[model samples]
Target: MNAELVEQYRLLHERRPDYGSGASHVERIAAIIERRGVRSVLDFGCGKGALVERLRARFPEVVVDGYDPAIRGRERIPLERYQMGYEMVIANDVLEHLDAEGYGEDLLEMGRLEPRWLFFNISCRPAVNVLPNGVNCHTLVRRPEWWREVLLACFPGFIEHGSEWNERSKGWMLAMTRPLELEGRRVAIVGNAPQAMGNREDVDGFDCVVRFNNFVVGDGYEAVGTRTDVLAIPACNRAVITPRLKRFTEGVSYVLDLATAGCVQAKANHGKIRQLLPHATIV
Candidate 1:
């Protein structure tokens, strides 16, 4: 990683409250709480502390803390003694940055805390903008099933939450899971390539594409010259207006746009997809 580029990310702690290049991922955590109450919350890699502030504001009753390895500025939690146990631990765009080396220690530290749940987005793909050689910010992006397996191994007994391609809008996957299992945890994908999910049920892909602005909003559309085998959000949400409950909505918008784009390379085997989603591929 370029020093200038790392500094750029630091500055983003100002203008880019969304984190991870407009994909802050706070809403997913917020969404998790909607399903279940979290008494303690930790925002790992909590840049600029915006998402941290958001959580403190919304769930004031719940205890919250912020952790980031890159931050050199004054942080809410002292750098050394920052790690503590919590009910919910959030690692929005933090895990992929671990390719920098020594990230395993950080992972073990979090494990020691043994939070009840881990909500985060791992890099599904890397951005060309950062690396002139065609590399991205992340180094360990295999596939969705691979990610699920890794998370389950790291913290077993937790219900697998969800993963969505944050490709066009950015290159990451939005994920969430809890310690105690839920009777039926749902996956709400907003993209077109439902087949990538392997599970034909909850996977949703569509036949159209959605175009957005610089901020990346879901607006107009384009035709699927080929197939619309992806999941879509607009088709399901039924309403255009979504609660701006947090800064991470932009990331959600990007995932939605990717879904509409029908751009996933991996095609889902209908049987395998059925095991994952069991709902039905939308496209």
Candidate 2:
């Protein structure tokens, strides 16, 4: 922890300690926890323990804990309490308080908590609140992209939910979760076009080639290459599913678009197509 930054926060807390009255912030986080099925949560830099209390009251089953270095008494708790990890780690309006010099270290420390999902509500703009020295309480104010880059560097494996501006909070809330690695090694989406013919070598190089509905292969084998890893069938083309098309799907993985799966299943050649690719994954 940066001593100087800590002192800045301590001074800021003296002036404006409470997070103010509003269940919107707490409710949003609660909704995420329920949606993600997060059983445990650690609210880092939880000011006044408002969110901690709200989460506890809202979700009795979930194990909710909070720690804030700046706040005193019950609001401030030891970090050692959550050494193992939590299902989700929330750092709402906390990162901006730290100095730019110690920002990376602060993020690294948060990463060490080893949460499956990280919900970061970062304030990109300057804060209305200020420290005793008249300096803005948000010391390390940065754009959402800058925060995204830093977060990704600290936690590489987590899949980022695109940054969205929240009008109510006037900040960017970034949600990242551990992704399902169902898609194998390398994936190249092959579009059905003339350009795809010229890009055969590039397409063939990928571990999986995702081709769209009724894609031609035999006629343009030399140009398009002979590797069909996954075939995507769109519902609009279900009427055109012929015997030749069923044969075209031989020995290839199938990616059925749910909207079109019902239509595709209704086709005469659907049985043969199903027989060819016994296990088809729906997208």
Candidate 3:
């Protein structure tokens, strides 16, 4: 970001309480965190740290840090943390505000922090606000393909996501992750039934153990086992959304919501389930 643009945003944020909003992207971000099994996150260009605050609230177990040159509290980028890197790094509605000449360096910085994954939401249209110098806030506005080329150049094999330029939003989103290998791993899908009990030793011996919604092993540890690598929930069913799911995530590496299961309202069901289970990964 340019020095003048940074000052302009700082002044704007100080004056307008709603100038740098991030709550709206929490659900989508949460889903990404769950899908990627991201334990630590760096919120690059985190204006006012709203997204960081919300992320901490939703995923208390996950570590979330924020940075932005304009924001007072989030102005300083932790040099040590950046060197350590993060499981996931997110930049929402922040890249477009950068000066075109310098945004590439900022993108490179984000890539450095993302050893595992990088999530981005970039605007491809002009912003409503103008700086004191009469220049639009979104100076680096460009189409999705342009952004794709930039990302590919920085991080090869990055993938584009569901986001597209909308009349109202005017931006696109992309997500990328390092390749994973799980072909030879032993995986056990345990159901919430009495029949799946009494094999605790065998279940725990697997490389990965998966369970279904509302699975209980309180006193039945000898039966169901305590280890849980993944949790699968029925996204279309409202009854399945419960607080118990939160307790299961401590040892769980992934939480999968069967959002695409054959249903009349699959898309709507997915959205509703995501809102209900904000910590679950919809598939």
Candidate 4:
């Protein structure tokens, strides 16, 4: 990102309160990424520049820049005059806000940056029939498959080799592994889909193969079970967002005594999100 644009992204993050309490989501993501020896990255939707701060703290010398169209703060990057590409891209909780202008043009613009790998997270609901929760502040709730098709077509050389999704969040969390080879590659969920968590019919378990299974029933996803033959990931897609590893990450997690899952705890990892998210569990 150019210096001015980077300034704009940072500006927006300044207003939002530090919300993603706990769960080491940032570090766990960094841990999975540290293995790559990343040099530079584009932290898309870098709210408060918090995640970028964590990435910098952990990776040390890695060059990390960010962008967010919503920000208008003093410490943010404007993103208008930015001119550069990145080796890696980090865009957590960014998809739900995308328009054809953002995901389409913005990505094509970023693609020119030539990022070898992208670390992104999107809004998702469990195939387990969870809850109607998108209204919670920042989630845009797009189809997980749409993400795969766009990314795959953009970066045809890579594949999501192994990823974990927190079934409870219904959100797909993953590590997009660089593609080794993509000749007729296929992926499928190996076990029985998780039982739906509650009664919201639209909210199903994270076994996205069920999402595609909907293709056979009609246009709209009829019911989770009606679409079975389709895999959790797209035929071209090679991943399933699973949970993160708790201990494998750089820091230790802490918890509170209350039964309610929403609680905040801090860690040495250099960012606010190091605080845990309620009901957040490691895969």
Top lDDT prediction, candidate number: 3
On TM-score, the leading prediction is 3
TM-score of each: 0.50, 0.61, 0.63, 0.49
lDDT (0 to 1) per candidate: 0.50, 0.68, 0.73, 0.46
How would you encode candidate 4's per-residue C-alpha lDDT over 221-255 as one tens digit per residue? 24432323222222222222112222221221111
User: Measured by C-alpha RMSD in angstroms, how accurate is candidate 3?
Assistant: 8.1
Q: What lDDT tens digits, residue by residue, belong to model 3 across residues 67-98?
A: 99998878866878877888888888888988
Write down the TM-score for model 4.
0.49
lDDT of 1 by residue, 99-171 (tens): 5445556666666666766776765665433433334546455566666666667665455445667556544
Candidate 2 structure quality by residue, lDDT tens digits, 161-235 = 435687776699887766433444566666677777676465677665667777787674666655775565655
Model 4's alpha-carbon lDDT is 0.46
User: How much lDDT does candidate 1 score?
Assistant: 0.50
